[model samples]
Target: MNMPDPVAVFRTEAAELFEQIESGLLDLTHRLNDKDQIDAVFRGLHTLKGSGAMFGFDALAAFTHHCETAFDRVRKGEKPATSELVAAVLAAQDHMRALVDRPTDDHGDIGEVLLARLRCAVEGDAQQPASVQPNPAVVVAEAPKSGSNTWRIRFSLPVNSMVNGTNPLGLLDELRDLGECKVLVNTSAVPSLDVLVPTDLHLSWDVTLTTDQPRSAIDDVFIFVLDDMQLDVETVTEVPVAEPVAAVSAPVPSTVAAPIPPVTMAVQAPVAAAATTERETAVSNADNRQAKAAENVRVPAERLDELMDRVGELVIAQSRLRQLASASMDIQLRSVSEEIERLSGELRDTMMVLRMVPVGSLFGRFRRLVHDLARETGKVIELVTEGETTEVDKTVIERLADPLVHLVRNSIDHGLETPEERRAAGKDEAGKVLLSARQAGGEVIITIKDDGRGINRDRVRAKAESSGLIQPGAVLSDQDLLQLIFAPGFSTAAQVTNLSGRGVGMDVVKKTVEALRGAIDVTSQTGEGSEVSLRIPLTLAIIDGLLVRVGTGRYVIPLSAVEECLELSLEEDLRSRGRSFISLRDSLVPFLRLRDLFRTGTKPDMHQKVVVISTGTERVGMVVDQIIGDHQTVIKSMSKLHHDVATFSGATILGDGSVALILDVAHLVAAGQQQEAQVRAAG
Candidate 1:
């Protein structure tokens, strides 16, 4: 058994905290007076600073402390939240991320620069007031007032708390900062040396403190560990001035404990005595927090990937066993194989569900991107997102993030008009960029749409001709012409800018989508803006497929795309031989003969089957010699040499240990549509 590196765990946590802080700041930009958003941002920063210090990320903690102070001012109503303040904190948050990632590297005065910006944002143009400009150390270590409430505090962290980069001494030090405090360790739970785990913490603490700060201040001290720790706090409304000298018998346990002499130490005597005074409210709250903590386990993503691979291998083994059972005539062996097959199928389904994450997590990061882009381009851009709850495979989501970023940037830079340009064109001053996701068949279609000046077809054609991508005056369909934008080194920008047009991103977007066994669709009107849709498979791992034999070769068509299968008699097949057209219920659908496409050089079976598959609005028929039953398809990527083969998306192993190609429905449907276009032109 290996333990996770606490540093790595803290880094992951810091990344999530950065996201939360960034999100709250972005929200605050719109509603500066929204106290909820203000408090959320402050808490996120506070947690980040405290956790950074715990994990030995000194630079991160130091840099974040300044940002936290800025927010603290806002929370205290000493300063109002302004756009400048939000922007300043947003920039500081990025620096904090870098510090968390590379704590040892020389960050080189960047912290000072950002802190200056923060101060300016906080103080604005007015002279800084004395109270609002207090020193950071003083702010943290302020003494308790003359007449402060007394409270008894007790807590015991989880056994693995120390292993998870929590410094119990640091938490105790924070309590001391509140005011005069006394802390005692309870070592009753310690195991024998032979059975003890060195890394585990078995000690608890009992503390009596006198502080003017409210109870919320105490809560803040334990906020990061509150979910998994048992904490009890009760106000000492009546405390005897002197109860027993034994209460102060033991010195504070840790070296980090303050040297301040214990004062009025008769709040509570010992852990045993405190246990008898069970405050139902505090205990019930602790139980509720612990219950909430147990609801979700934070497993590392790589672990999930490893589990998925194991499941995939198990599925393959089950398939092989089923084949063996089918050959042997033993009833018990056959029954066992059937049982394993059912179990493997269910396991695959469950693994897939674990890997499926809501697309909203992917969408949430774009809010900061749009905010930054709006400021950079001086464009009044409004970003709208829909269908965020639609789910897709986590792997697919991870891979699609870069492609989506490029698409959104291109939409804003190329498709959207500036506010001045929009107003002159009789449109609203603000341009709208819409991002949405929805499931279609087996694919998740993510669409990036913008309402601005549409693509200039004439400009694209001129650039394509100049680059020799297409011949001058070459006749092409609108769809084909639109696709030229994705060609390598293709750009319609008149001048290069930081965001786009070194002729770089669009081509990579196309290649990446293709690599995922996905397709890209583009639509534009002359003046109504443009829309780019990326159709990617919901999962890259496994799928339910309809297996069929085309000539001597076996192929798998995704079941989600299969509408219905029809038997093609020899007479009907021969009648439609030249045109390859099939009529069904008043519509003439084009069909592709896979035997001829693969050049198998074998005659088709007398009674052929046409598997009708659809991608979006286009449907195509695939002619195969035999229709095999449904099979659980664990998708395997084709080798680099055969990766460009557009007819098949991937390959899967059959129960008989042969490879079956998975058909690319989008490509086949496009081919069918092209054939229909050519036939119509001939007429």
Candidate 2:
């Protein structure tokens, strides 16, 4: 078992904390009055500062301290949480991430600039409003009781306390300052010298003290290491004897055996009689705080990835076992194989669930994008999101970020109009961008819709013709023309701007989607709006594929794309040599002959099979010799040299020890569309 590097763990944790803080701040910017979001942001910052300090990130701790203090004020209602304040903190959060990532690197003037903004946010440029002084009576009511009480303290420093620069002596010294104190080091579990690690603390402590300070003071002593350590404290009765005596020598009372109600009695008896009940309630409050502080658990991301890898290997092993069992004649072997198959299927399902994460995380990022783009473009834009709870594989989510950012930028910069323009067009001044995600037929469809000036098809056609991307008077569908926007160096924008338009982003989006084995579709109407949608596979690791034999070589078609399989009659096959079209349910579906397409010099089977497949409105039939059953395909990418081959998306290994190329559904569908157009043109 390899141990994680503590420093690396700290860096990872700090990065996640910064992201959570940034997300909360961005959300609060939209709804300033949302107390829950304000408190959440405050807690995130508070935890980050404490955790940084615990991990010996002093610079990060100190930097986060200022932001935490500001948020604390907001949480307490001493200062109102405002957009300007959230923006300032968001900027500071980025700097804090830099500090966590490279503590030794010089931040230069970035820190100074952010600090100035924070100060301005904290202290508005105008004169400060008169400070409302609290009533003296209320202050008295909140003051701590003045009396000595015995405290039984039990605590264990975190396992890595010493290495993290924490000194247990400091806590002991603070306890000693409270009054008479007896500290006993418990080393009963300390290992032998040969087995012991010097850097790891193996000692805990039991301390008995008499103090006049409130219990909160003791908690403050361990606040920095609270999350990583175990601590228990209970107030005991004050010694009956007047003078402070040695705790070891003091007589034990049965009343102190159980440390709860008696501790409540000791603190409140000396104060007003009614204060005893309040002190009991305060003890419970302290327990609640400790419970919440202990609830957080951190696990390394690599551990999850390792588990996924093991699951994948298990799936492959199971596939091999199933293949061997089916080939053998032993009934018992087949039975065991069946059992293993069921278990492996269940394991694969579990692994997939583990890999899936809610798309809400991806949705949260766009809030900040919209905020900044609104400011930069000087347009009032409101972003609406739906179906955020849709779950997709983590790998898919990771790759989708950049393309989504580009789409959003294009929507704001090019698709959406300025507030003045929107109003003049009889639309709402604030433009609306709706981003949504939903699962449909093994694919996650993410749509980005904006109500603004739609794409100009005439301008696109004109641009394509001028650039020689298309013939000057060539006939084309509106959808085809719109797709030309994805071509390199093609832009319909009248003027290029910093945000987008030198024809760069959309092409990248197209390439990226294709690289992920996904497809993109665009729809727009003049003066209405534009919607761009991406259909990406739910998971890239595996798929349910239909295996077919093409000229003794096997090929797998995505099961999601297959509609039906039909046997070609002898006369129909002989007649359709030049043009292959199958009649299925009174509809003429064009077919591709795999043997001819692959240039295989083999004679066709007497009865060939036509597999009908469709993607959206386009349908095609693939001619093959045999229709094999459904297969659980573990998709492996093609070699870089063969990456540009449009005929196959990926390759998979069959149970019979043969390689099968997974047909590219989108590409074949496009080919079918071309075939249909040519046949019509000939007619």
Candidate 3:
């Protein structure tokens, strides 16, 4: 097996770390004093900086340090987390991502500009003035006589600690900061040169100090290493004047017999007890990390895709075996076919679950998008998200990102009103935008809603009429009219701006969503807000379909969308032939005769079935000659030559090896609506 390139691994992990940092910063903007968010952001930045440097991404590491430093200041409470600082860090994160992605590319002076802005934000927050002073420096002008005392601390760090960036000398230096101090090195544990590990630490320390500070101050000296290192801390009192010479031997240790100190030199007893308590906690944390590392392995996404392809081929082969088994009378062959079919299905389902990832991964990046858009438009926009736990295929998530970006930008730039406008409308000064996702059977619905002035129907109508998209007074339903916004080159704005009014985004959003075999729905109530929903399939690889035949031609209807199938009586069908509807449950449902749609040029069977399918709450029925039962449909893309065929989403192979087209529910529904509109118009 080939090992993955370490650099590539770092970049992938770096992306995730950047997302965490950006998300933490954005969350901090809403609650500036959230200590948890502050610390989380700091850790993310710190980890990213360290990992980048380890992977030889020097520029990325260098750029990320400024951000880490800024968050550190906030984490330490040296500077309050301010909106300006959060925004500045958010911007810097973008630059860091660029550096991580294209490390060798000349970044020019972008880093300096972002760093300068960060510095300004930090300094600006610093200028607010302090209310109270903190602890003074470690070395003070000769300790005050009233509270002067000494502390005796003996500690030994883990042997491998020094190589992992812990400096024993640095810890000792901190101890000296308390007051006048003397440190004795204990090196008895050192092995002979022949048996020694040169990189390991084989020594410990004993420190005697005098200071006016409290006992807690002594603990502060070893704050970073206290949990893992062996440290014993206790206050040492003054020597008796009467028996000053006796103090030297009062508590002398058997291991260290030579000691001539002004104060008493005691054996390490009480200090050892304090260290024992922390040892268990340290050991437990180490064990947990080790277990976690053993349990998980990081594999590249391409490998998973390759595995899925192999599974798909296995499924196709199983279908062939089933067909052969049914024709032959060999009991053994039939039994083997059934076994393979069962195993292949189990494998396919497992592969699908592996491909399914939570939509939260996609929703996270939008927070940053909303943050930047609010700044650019100078609007007070608050983003609210829901249904984040909904999951979709990884491939679908990747493809939907750009289209979702366009939709969100359009909402912020076009649908939302400014603060003044919102105020005039008696709404809150700040506008709100909601992004949500949820699963309905096999489809995942992603919606973007904004509490701004809704679609201007009159303006849309005018633009559509002028652009020849519709007649001047076309009698379109509210849903139909809202959709006109997606027409190419359709814009109702009086003037063009950088953000919108250029007649661009909405149409491209439609195209992209449709390419993914998804549908777009727009609904708006004037002055209330507007909602745009993209309903997409959970996966494009394979699906459970209801295979049916109209005349001699066959098609697959996604099983997730099928609600029920009922026999259509010839009298009932003929009674509603022109209207193309069936009265079921006392409500009229529009029906399409597949025979007519496909132009099969064959007569319909006496017993026809109406398969009721839905996209959201809207249902349409398909009139078919036969219900051919369920199939494990492996979705194959339409060739570019037939890519524009709207009636079919994709084609698949049947067990008999015949080609069958998968119906595009969303498109067919839209076509049914359009067909209904045309019939009414003629009437």
Task: Give the winner by TM-score.
Answer: 1
Off by over 4 Å in 1: 127-165, 172-219, 223-289
Order the candidate numbers by TM-score, best to worst. Answer: 1, 3, 2
**Candidate 3 ranges beyond 4 A from true positions:** 125-295, 569-576
Higher-TM-score candidate of 2 and 3: 3
Please give the CA lDDT of all the candidate structures.
0.84, 0.79, 0.81
lDDT by residue (tens digit), candidate 1, 271-385: 2254443334345656785788799789989899999889988998999998899899999999999999899889999999999999999999899999999999999988899
Model 2 misses residue 292 by how many Å?
9.9
Candidates 2 and 3, the one with greater lDDT: 3
Higher-ranked by lDDT: 1 or 2 = 1
Tell me the lDDT of model 2 at 392. 92
In candidate 3, what residue range of length 10 has the lowest lDDT sum? 134-143
Could you give me the TM-score of model 1 versus the true structure?
0.84
C-alpha RMSD of each candidate structure in angstroms: 6.5, 7.9, 7.1
User: For residues 1-683, what per-residue lDDT tens digits would candidate 2 score against the true structure?
Assistant: 88778788777767677778877787787789999898678767767776677677888876776787677567656677777888888888879988888889988878767776776686666553368432321211122234466678889987888886677876786577556677889999799999999899989998887766556556655655665677777656654445445542453442545644665566556543433444454456567767876995556656767776677667667778888998999999999999988998888788788778788889888988898788778999999999999999888898899999989998888788998999899999999999999998878999999998998888989999999999999998777888998999888777888887698888889998898888888999877889999988888877888988877788899998888888986678899877777777898889888888888788788898899887666799988988878888878889999988988899987765677999988888888778878887887
Q: How far is candidate 1 from the true structure (C-alpha RMSD, Å)?
A: 6.5
Runs in model 2 lying further than 4 Å from the true structure? 127-317, 576-579
